[model samples]
Structures are given as structure tokens and as C-alpha cells.
Target chain A: MSQSTVPARGAARTSGTVRIVGAGLLGASIGHALTALGVDVVLSDTSPAQLRLAVDYGAGRPARGDDEPRLVVVAVPPDVVAQVIEQELADHPDAVVTDVASVKLEPLHALRARGVDLTHYIGSHPLAGRERGGAISARADIFIGRPWVVCRDAETSSADLAVVEGLALDLGATPLEMDPEEHDHSVALVSHVPQLVASLLAGRFVTAPEGSLRLAGPGVRDTTRIAASAPELWVQILGSNAEPVVEILDVLATDLAAVADALRHPDAPGARRTVADSIRRGNEGVERLPGKHGQNRRFAQIVVMVDDTPGQLGRLFGELGDLDVNVEDLRLEHSPGAQFGLAEISVVPSVVHGAVDGLTARGWKIASMPND
Target chain B: MSQSTVPARGAARTSGTVRIVGAGLLGASIGHALTALGVDVVLSDTSPAQLRLAVDYGAGRPARGDDEPRLVVVAVPPDVVAQVIEQELADHPDAVVTDVASVKLEPLHALRARGVDLTHYIGSHPLAGRERGGAISARADIFIGRPWVVCRDAETSSADLAVVEGLALDLGATPLEMDPEEHDHSVALVSHVPQLVASLLAGRFVTAPEGSLRLAGPGVRDTTRIAASAPELWVQILGSNAEPVVEILDVLATDLAAVADALRHPDAPGARRTVADSIRRGNEGVERLPGKHGQNRRFAQIVVMVDDTPGQLGRLFGELGDLDVNVEDLRLEHSPGAQFGLAEISVVPSVVHGAVDGLTARGWKIASMPND
Candidate 1:
């Protein structure tokens, strides 16, 4: 089992030679970052064209077989990830190996099924992405300020784990250690299940009358927002982590049926309770999230009406800056043909009075809306 | 049967005495808007306290029994909406009666079953509200540019239907006409089903490990944002439109079960296809909705790295305004424990190159990310 303290962040967080397998978005981005930090990076990919593109983009030099890398990172599609990890482990036997695949348990389970050596292998995932892919779209700072999860197994050495964490720290990502099972389950609950749910909800609108779609408000907008993600990428992710995802989906489906049944006979005994409980449970569930709802309770929200004109919002924000009020969060709300938008600015309660006074003095109209 | 085009836009969209039967959020808001337009508003409510509050807020004057209203609007809880509408029509036999209940079919059906007179009654719903309720949170501009749907029956006269449409136009809402059945089914697809789906997805997180919850990202955030709605209020809504909502939920549950089954056996024949179809259908469905992933196709997104400082976002937006590029939509993204956030601002494609050049020239870091 691995046991290591988190790396102490300093002027330099990563060191020695690092090898990155795959020259796609994640892999080349890692190469570009490490090379910028003065680390020797050897990049590899099955596609000569992609590898050459990465090298041309200064991500890293093409991988040379003779090179002895201290660490190896596999960043390939989820379907072929385990095979790639096995190849990297055998090719660079002395190097600490990690793969930046979204799913952790599947690859480890796949490798273990074949009894492949895993002493040097670790699994990690960074929760960062863009609308595009490939080396041409790669950027060094894409992983900055995102969660880089590192999963270590019983066979992973503490030194190897630290190397992985060090890489995360160097990229300005927050590193958190989790076992493979924990990592998979966590993502299933937060990422994979939510994706399917959004898809299911959005799919309902496909056959809806066009007029109904026009009545869509913030509620449906927020719920189905993620349904537009690419199916190919999601299929791989959902397939790799099918067991956990299916477990969540099965329960979710059952719950939906229960609510439907309750609605079908709302006057029956306990029918109303059943429907209420589903929504109440949802309230409790969402509250467990890190940034729970009722955020307005902690941060005072000053609802300011902004005109649809170009500089109006800019001027409002600029004035808030002048008042030295750091807006913790903000939400923009508008109707289909409304000329004005409402900007709900969340600031610390202590500064709210001053913010309101300052905004009013600046001739801003603040709308008062209280919770029932 | 009523046959009429929508009311024409005019300087004075409403005239004569208007009576609102309930002083709740929607009712008081209508009263406030009409009162401001120099129209006589007669407001009534079962709760004297609420009626007084609305009156004190200048929403409307107290309803006098002797006064004949030109139009009567019923705004109350969904469970009692039909009962109130029946009473309103009987009390003001000469006035055109409309109710702002969310579900139109249930109330209309309830009224028909009771053998109530229907000639002067038209059902309507304004798709406008706030997190809060009652006159305390009411505003004159709440309905501005929002959809106001009017449902007319075969017994409705053209003059009465126009009265209802005029009410919508007076409140600055665009009125659309549909039969009660169409309105109910549309809301079920766009609003009710989505609400339940969000609640169902969020309910799964009730027992999730804290660590997993920390990995929550935009997908989960967007999907579960509405799960915090009041359970009591939702129970009534779900019950009132149970037939339509249940129909949608049944199909959604069936779809969910199929995807779950596919994930359980991803390698089996046609399993991956099932999963892929679910997501593909989602893509098609969300495309039917007004926004997207389609938003991405329309607007070029410029992601700028912003320091978590007071003036960083303000400066970015101000600079965008200076470039004369109006940001169509925006998203602020950051990870826990990160010192900087990424502001993804969507701008019209025509202005993207110029906006990006301006931002880059102003020393803003724009990260390039491509679709995978």
C-alpha cells in the first residue's frame, strides 16, 4: 500500500524525466505543461501524425525507445486505456505509471484480470475539458484549478504516488487521493449518473410540440443543460463505468416509477406522501453537495436590473469593483423578449448594505424579492 | 367558439375595471402592473392579511362588491383553482374570467364536470414567477416578455378571448392561443417532467460519500439546481397535472431502464447501441429546445483565465464592452481551492475574432480547447 504526504508546493512541483503516452488533448497538454517547467517529456501515440503535431506544437519531443523516463502517463480513449496502460508498464518497467482516464476501477480490474504487473501503475483523472479535442486544441493551463484525482492501489509505491501528486500540483490542480472503487463510485454519483439523467429528461422534449418548447424556463434549462454532450465520448465513459452507473440508474428508474404511480393515484392513501417524499429527498440530497443551496442565506443577493444594452452589465460590474465588493457568485435571468435582465449578485452579508447603498447612489435600481 | 388573432400591440393594452381574485404573487404582480398603467384594479383574497398587504403595497384597491369589473383574473393554489374559477364566473357573470393557474386542462375539466357555465370563462397561464410568493415579492415587470398562454374552449366567445389576450398584452407578455389539452401536454413535457427528473437525479446524492460530492461539476450542478424547490408546492402541481406528468414520467422511466440494462451488459449485442441511442436522442431533444449545445454552434466561446481578485471579471467584461461585443451568455468556472476562475463568455461568431484579439491585446489569457 502507498503512504505519502501530499507534495509541498514550491517554486517547482515536478522534476525528472516524464513520459506521456497518447498525443491527444490530455496527453499533449500534459507534455506542453511539463516541458514548460523544464522537465524532459517524451511523448508517444499510435498516430504518427498526432505525435508529430504534438512535437510541432512544442508539447514534447517524440518518444525515443532508448529514453529512461522516471514516470509514464497513459492518456488514451477509455475503450483501449487498459491495453495502453499494460503496454506502458511493460515498456517502461522502472517508471512509475499513471493513466488519465475518467474511469479508474475498470482499467485496474482489466489489468488485474490478466494478472498483469501493477506495482508501478496508478490511475488518475483530471476533471477538466473543453468543447474541442486534439493536439491542435491542447493548452498547457487547461488543467489549472481543476480537480486532479489520483487513485493508488495496494501495490503502488509511496514514491510513485508522490510523483503523480507532484504532477497534479505542478499543473495548478488540486490533488486528492482515492482508491479505485471510491473514485469510480464518486464519479458515478456526481458525473455519470447526472449525465444519463439529463439525457433522459432532455430526450422527452424531442417529440414535444414546438410551442411547448417556447415556454421552457430556468427550471428545464438548468435540468437538461448537459444533455447536448457528444454521445460517442459519453458511451465510452458510461461503458467503462457501467456497473456503478447502472446501479445508480436502476434506483433512479425505480424512484421515477414510484413517483409516477403516486401521481396516477394522488388521492389514494399515502400517494401524496410518496410524491412529497421524492421531492423532499431531492431537497436533502442536493443539500449534501459541497456548495449546497440556500446560498442566499449565507451570501446576501442584491438583485439589480440591467438593461439589455451592451455596456450596462459591464458598467454594473465595474461599479461593484469600484465599491471593492467581490461578488461571490452571480446569476443572469431574462425572459424571451425582455429588454432587461436581472443580475443576482451574491456578496457577503456585511458588505450588502454598503453594496446596496453604493449601487443606489450610482442610480441602479435594486428589486426586492423575499423568500416565502 | 372563439376565433380571434392575438390582440394588437397598442399604447394602452388594457382598459376598464380589472378584478383579481387572489392576492398571491401572480395576482398581486398583475395588479401592480395594471395599476401603474392607469387602469382600475380590484383585488380580492380569502386571506385578509395578504389582501391588506397587497393593498398597502399599492398593488390594487380592495374589491368593492358593487363595482363591475371588465375582466376577472383568478390566481390561487392549484388544488383550489377550479373551485375559485367557478365561483369567479358566477360572481361576475358579465365579465370575462381567466385564471393564471399553471395547468389549464385540469381546471377546465373540473369546471366542465361540475356543469359550470363556461361562455364567459377562458383559462390562461403566465409563465412568470419568483422563488418567493405573495404580494411582498410581487413586481410589475415580472410578466414582461414572458409567455402568456390562453386556452379557449368551444363555448368561449371571441370578445371574451380577446379580453384575456388583452390582459396578457397589458402585462407586457406575448400571448399565444391553444386548446386546454395542448397547453397541459406542453407544460408536462417542458416543465413538469423536467422537474421530476431533476428531483430524481438529485435524490441519488442523498447518501453519497462526501468525497464524491466534492467532485461535483457543471453537469450535476446544472441538472440538480431545481431540486431545492418546495416539496409541498410541487406536490400540488404534480397532482393537478398528474395524468400528463405521469405519462411523461412513464416513458422516461422506461428509457432509463433500457439504458441501465444496456450498461449492465455493455459488451452484449446492441448494448452499446442502446446506451448510444439514449445520449443521441438526448442530443436531438435538447436541440429542439431553444438553446444548447446549439448555443455553442451559434456563439464562439472565449475562455479567459481570471484571477480570483475583485476586479478581474469586471475588467474582462468592461473590456468586452469596449470592444463593442455583447456577451450572449456567460459561465464562470473554477475548482475548489483554486485561485483563478475561467470565464467562458459566448459572443456572436462575427465578433469573436475581433473580441479575442482585443482581449488578448489587453493581456487576458485565452485558452484554446477543441471538441474531442
Candidate 2:
């Protein structure tokens, strides 16, 4: 129900219909964005109920028999992506087809081995999603400001490439180009490998004593949060993106063994140094993370204490608003047993002193000084 | 600067001075809590400036030559905990002494090997802390609702055990009893090993290409957050609790290898099943975690879309207050480039429909359905 005020930028679409072959979250959301941009769109799916839900959500209407689509977007699970793309290309000979599967190279290889015409097909993946599925969770603004990588090869025509890039732009996303294999390896490093690691670490707690878990703090809670992600979906994602993920996990297992051995014989020569160096590398690794607006600049955080009651956070933010201190980011830390919560507000360095002074004057308790 | 309205819930202690041997975060915070409960607290540290800072913050006064302390708390680094406890026991022959080091067995063994009298000494660890250290980050309520594990042997006198438990209670902590070895193994499982795993995982990111790092999401971010913890401090913790942590890490390394091998050869016997079983085990592990108030009950979350401007979050929370929705927990998500943020408010299931309908009627955009 929210709207973006940023105007669309790109060459005019010159009137064409885009047909989407799936009615899941991504497909419906794509249709919603294209429809908003004045492009005639059609949605098709195997399940009539799912197709109707997407249509009712204003993604698109049922496909018309007489329609001639210029672009066919295949939005489906990774395992079926290659088969769906092959079929769509056959169904609409002139349309440039693209499949939004997470694993690009595997599907490309599948289609290539089947001897399909590769000139009109491109592989693309939008790095925006939710833990839940279905059209009910779909939103037109899900991809805004997110990266949508398009996989292009030598055979992809310039005109076809522009159409895909234009669609990404119209959906308020920044489209970047990468080869299929490169995209797979990048996501494996960032996404798939992390998922497996989180799962494996969380599995350790399954048989733990209740009393031991009573001592579980924020550190353990955070390090295992992603383990709650839907396993069925991840099974498919990991299965298709297997090779690169396996490679990363193998390397991580080796490092894990090294740390274990060092801890086992801490008195051995250079053992403590090995432990220290491993942790230091972690320090350097986290520092490479980009800050606000993709800049390397870090913001300072000011913590204020608030009671765990209605309107407490609202009143705190209101006081901050009166002081004209723009909060760049905010994190709330509280447990159900605690009677109060701490609101950590991030702001640029220049305004921190003023913000702290103003909040303290307003009777807000300062918990800690500005920290990175 | 804030005060807890919840009255202290322990037997009235009409007592003499309690001496604290360190003036850092934990030492000063314990002094602060005991002082609030009408206990005479004497503080001492090697650094005069640090001692004065703790005193200025009302944690305690400087120790006096004629003073007689009934209890002495040794709150120092893990590596020096044994030496500090020995010195404290020697100084206060008639007093009961406890060391608040993270690892328990190492210090106990060191004192036993040194032939120190064991009747008046207890090893304890309060599972409460902040990422930052020093008197500046000290809080009186840090121990509230947290587990304080007291390690007592057969030689520990009833009077000394009661005094230690009383100290834990006076600080608003739930005191649980365990042997030194059991306490060490428990913490190694819950705290120390997770720290190593997080650091090792984050260490991999140090040399990652910029493009691969760009794809990092909340999953990777949460799994590696504790990697930013102070490395020198953790090196000592892991070294002190080496046996259990190393044992767990070794087992985890084996499991990681199995998952990797399975992913590498999905067609091999039971390979796909192994991957799914590993993920399923993670789900079971997470389900074992207690929910709010240390109960197994789960709460439903109400997500409301908030605009990126000042006062938007305040307005939404203010509306929730008017509707009498008690927010159990809250999380905020937004990217710097996005025009809006989402506030995920957790509430009890019985009130979820009411909260959703009330917020929706008041013009709030619902992003997702209620989730645990």
C-alpha cells in the first residue's frame, strides 16, 4: 500500500506485453512492478488457485490466446528452471526468455546440453527475497535499491540485453552484469555457504541440556538465527548450487580442524599464536563490510535506556526528532524477563555530542558512549 | 542513571563490608548492585585511576587499612583469576572468597595444586556481560534474570556457600549450583565454542572478492557478528576452557566434513538424505530454545511498514500504544538506499488479530503475516 516517489528512468518501453510463467512470490512481484510501469502483462502457472491469487493481487490478468509477448520471464524453483525455459522458448519463438533462478550456470548447462537456441535466453537473479513464500507476501517494492544480476554471454543480442536491463530499471533495481559461473560462485560464498554453516552450528544445540541453554546469550542467538529459515527451499537452493558451496564448506572444515588442533595443544609451539591470528583475521574480515549507502564510512552508536512499556520507544524517537538528530540506524535489545530495553541509535560523528546532550537533557538515560 | 522499580527479592542481609578486588566492568557492576541493597562495599585495583572511576560512579569506596571484609569477590581476567583468588583468600583469612572468571576448573585446580585452604573459596561465573568493558559500561541490573553458576566442592563450608549465594541473590541473579568441572564443560559448550566458530567463519571473509561480499545478507551478518569481539580476551577464555571447546569443535569439524562430502556427491548412497538430515537437526535444535520468559511458548510477530522519514516509527508505535498492544520484542530492518523501513513487533497470539486489524484500520501497511 506504500508508494515510491522516485520517478522511473529508462528509454520508453514502446508498448509490449511481458508474460511470466510462474505465480510465486518473485513472479507475481515482477508482474506487479511491470504492470505499474504501464506494460501489458500476463501470468501463467500450473496451479489455477495460485494463478488466481496473483491475478487478484493485481500482478496480471490471465493470458489471452491472441497475445504476442515480447519477453517471457520464467520465475520458478531452480530444479525446474531449465525445463521451463526450454518450453517457454518453444512456445514463443520471437520472445527473449530469461529465467530468475538462483543457480545460473547449472540451468544454462542443462539448456545447452538439450541443444536449445541460446541466443534469446538470458539468466538473471534478483538478490531480494523474504523467508516466506506465495503471492500474499509479494510486494512491488521488494527489489527497490537491491542488486539484480543479469547473466550475459557472447550470443546474447544487445537489443535483448537492453530489454532485460530496462525491466530491472523499471522495477527500481540496479542491474549489473556477470557471467553465469561467476554469479554462482559469488552467491555460494555469500549465501549458500553461510546457510549451511548456520544450520550445522545450530544442530549442536539439539541434544544440549536445558540448563546449559539457560546460559545462552545474545552471541549464540545471533550466530544461529538463520538456522530457522525454511529447510525445504534451502535444500533445493543448495542442491542446485552444490559445487561452489561444497568447495567453500570443504575449506571452512579445514580451518575448523586447524583451530580445533590448536586449542587441543595450546602449550605447543605457536599454538596460541595460531588461535590469535585466526581471531584477528575475523576482525579484518568484518571491517570490510560496507557501511551506510555502500560507503566505507562507519557511524557511531548512542545507547539510550527506555522502559518496556507502551509508547516508550515512540516517545524516545519523538524526543530525538525534536532535537533534529537524524537517526541513521537503530537496534533494540531487550529480553522478555527484563523490565527495560536499550535503544541503540546510529548517527554520524559530528551530531553525536549534540544528540547525546539533547537526549540526556530530555531525561533519557545514556547507557553507553558512542561506539562503532 | 536509571533505577529499577522492582523491589529486591531476597532475605534482608545485615552485614559487614564486601570487598571487590577489580574495578573493571563486572567488579564495578557487582559493587553497584550490592551498594543499592544497603551493603558496605570496599573496592581495590592495581590502577589507582580505574579504582577512582569506579568509586566516582558509586560502585564502592577505596579499601581501608582497618576494614574487615566478610566476603571478597575476585573479578579479573581469566588467566589471572587463580592468582587473584589465592591473594584475596590470604588477605581475608576469615572471609569467604569467590572468583568471577568465565572458566572454573582451571582456577580450582591451580589453587588445589598450590595447597591453598579450600573451605572459604568458591569458583563462580555470572553469565552476564556487555561487549564493551571498563567502569563506563557497568550497570547495576546486568545480572538481573541471568544465571549465576556457583562451583562448590565438599570442603566448602555451609556458611561460605550461603554467603556466595546471598551475594548472587542480592544482585538480583538466580544462583545455580554446579561442580567446577561441570560448570567448565557447560560454558564451553554454550559460549566458548560458539565464539570460535563465529570467528573462524568470519575469518573466511577477509580475502573474499568485493563482488562476492556484496551479496552478503542478514543471514551472513547475524552468523558472524560475535567475530568482532575482543580477540585477546577470547584467546584467554578458549585457552582456559581448552578441553571441552576443542572436543566440541573437533566433533563439529567431522560433521562439517560429512555435509561437504554429501553435497559433493549427491548421487552417492544417502548423500541427499544426509544433507536434509543435517538441516532437520538444526531445526530441531532451534526448537529446543526456550521462548520469552524462559518458557517454551512462542509469540506472533506483527510487521508494519514504516516510511524512512523522522517520526514515522514514532507514529506507528504510538498508535500501537493507543490500541493497548504490548510489544514483547521488536526488530527493525531497512537499507540505507531504501525509502522505507519495517518494524516487526512481537505480541502474544491471542492479541495478534486485534493488533493487526487495529493497525491496519489506522492506515498502517502490513508487510507480512504474524510469524514466530
Best by lDDT: 1
Give candidate 1's chain B TM-score.
0.88
Candidate 2, B139: how far from true, in Å? 4.2
Show the lowest summed lDDT stretch of 10 residues, model 1 chain A.
A1-10
Pairs that collide in candidate 1 are A131-B370, A131-B371, A132-B370, A132-B371, A133-B370, A133-B371
Model 2 error, position A257 (Å): 1.2
Q: What RMSD, rounded to one decimal, does every model reach?
A: 4.7, 4.2
lDDT string, candidate 1, B1-372, tens digits: 001211222344577899998998999999877887678899999999999999999889998869898899999999899999888888888899899998988888888899998889888999888755778878876776678999887888888888888888777678988888888888888888887888888888888878898888767887898887778778888899999899888898889888988888777899989999889888888888773345456766677778777767777777777888887667676555565667777776778788878988998877543222
